[model samples]
Target: MTHPQIIARCHPALEALLPKPTAARAALPDWLRAMPSEAPAETLNGDPVRTLKHCPPFLDALSLGILIPLATDLHFDKGAVSWDWDPPALPDTLISRSPIALHLPEQATGAPYPLAVNSILKFLNFWTLEAPSGTSLLFTHPLNREELPFRTLSGVVDCDLFRDGYVHFPALWLDRDFTGTLPAGTPIAQVIPLPRSAPPELTVTTMTEAQITANRALQTDLATTPGTYRKRFRH
Candidate 1:
């Protein structure tokens, strides 16, 4: 039978038994099996663990793994799912409550979900594959991501060197519905990069030394002048 049909029928069965999936699967590490995505259970993969301990593990446990999509690891990290605006409080190598913010077509209705990133830097592109043109991707980070914090805020996607380079911006800026600006908490992944070369007619504009001196002198004269009408100064 097809996987979808199989999963549809089996979900009720799994929910009925409500067995301790983690305890059932002996092979997986504890973090791998105890994901809260499926049920009310302790979190897994928030940090490195000794081992996985679950019957099925994340998507693997769903409907006897009949409908578990290929590359499940890429779609869902071995951890919790959340929509928290606050930056996750994570150790260098740990899972905090965060989702990868994949840009997709707008939904028919309802607010969007929150996404998170591990503070530790890692290479996202390494984990990414091709997606449909309209499909924005959110990379679910496993707690293991914490262990290998990218030595830098690595980009999974190619970007402009200037606009996308290593720079720490304020977190408050991330929440804005930015126009001609990056989104709040916008990760290194989904950046709208700038061009590398200057335009033919490009020119640098700055206040001249003469202008700066004139402005400073004007300010000083105003501060020193009396409140009453003052005599005009000779050049």
Candidate 2:
């Protein structure tokens, strides 16, 4: 099926520095790219929840949205921060003038939040994300990316009407002691475009006897066959 497109726009100065966002499903790891293992090897200390929920396809699809990467290397030393633009950029350029602007806690958080820290700051990565006439852009942290030192707050923007405006990512600093180089091209946010139509009405009811029997039979088949879901069920 043909789907709508999500366009990424940037300043002329950043045309060469920052490439457009890429498809998240492309160039996935071998384990995810490969077919489901018929006789999968279990780890010595594997959690059942992880084993079940953290399947290759599941994790891959969660990350199968879109990714926006950083344009320059960022370094945080003690209280001083610096931005090192990769090549093309002059050394004398103002490092303090950050492309990723900072938003005050009050600006991000509507009401007076009662956090212990008095000076809470968030980094707002710049991106002009646009979608079709009736769609909005949904932003969130990349799935299974625990190594990153920050967490992007989830948000949705009505990009269809607000396409001209830039959508900035508000991220909380999770690791304070992280004083290394955050290399350029490191993905800072994952975005998904969703239609803004009215959602389907909720209908709750008891399962029919036939459905119950079918579900039980399917459960039994899954219990007996290792690749029942992957081979027989999944399209």
Candidate 3:
């Protein structure tokens, strides 16, 4: 099968200095790597059951697409944020020197974010992404990255049509007490390119006799088999 290509463009001078976007699989979190596939647990029969480490869907969601990493190390102390990145001199004056930006409290006055921080922070993306002609890019917080101190706001952009400009990510600072460095290579966003075709119409109906029978068989298999979905359903 042919795969669609996604391109990332940045200043030629900062090519080596900046952390390039990476595949989500290549950037799995440390906690995930340290987790065991199975641990001592109590099932109904007192047997050890599989953990999320052995779950394909959870792993697949974390490995879905490309991850856009922070270009520089971000330091947060008290309520202050700072970075220490010095990019090579470039002719383009439009590029941002700082790794982050801010949105005033008034800008998000009525927003329903869980956090009560006075301002919204944005990760400055220096790279421009280009997807296939008929696709858009879904930009969201890195999947299953709940350990991070902020929640990135989700957005969809017609990247195929809007590849000329940068797409910064806005996030709510969830931990005001978090004071440390978010390393330069930390993933800030996950980008998944999806086709622009409209989805099929929704249909609501009662299950047919065959469908009910199939559901019963599936349930029985799930109860009896350890890896039924992994062995037969997952591609």
Q: Pick the candidate with the highest TM-score.
A: 3
RMSD of 2: 5.2
TM-score of each predicted structure versus truth: 0.17, 0.75, 0.94
Which is superior by lDDT, 1 or 3?
Answer: 3
Error of 1 at 65 (Å): 14
Q: How well does model 3 score by local distance difference test?
A: 0.89
**Runs with alpha carbons beyond 4 Å of true place in candidate 1:** 1-51, 55-129, 143-146, 149-235
RMSD (CA, Å), each prediction = 25.2, 5.2, 1.7
**82-147, model 3: which lDDT tens digit per residue?**
888888766665877778998987887687776546789999999999999999999999999999
Task: Name the TM-score of candidate 1.
Answer: 0.17
lDDT of each: 0.27, 0.66, 0.89
Clashes of 2: 0
Error of 3 at 55 (Å): 1.0
Give me candidate 2's TM-score against the actual structure. 0.75
Q: Which stretches of model 3 miss by more than 4 angstroms?
A: 42-47
| Candidate 1 local lDDT, 1-235, one digit each (tens) | 5211110111222233212212112323344445543443347645443232322233233212111111112222333222323433435433322323332323312534332332221221211122223222222222122321121221232222122222221111122222232122222222222223344796888889999998788878766763211344421
Angstrom error of the Cα, residue 181, model 3: value is 0.5
- Lowest lDDT sum, 10 consecutive residues, model 1, at 63-72
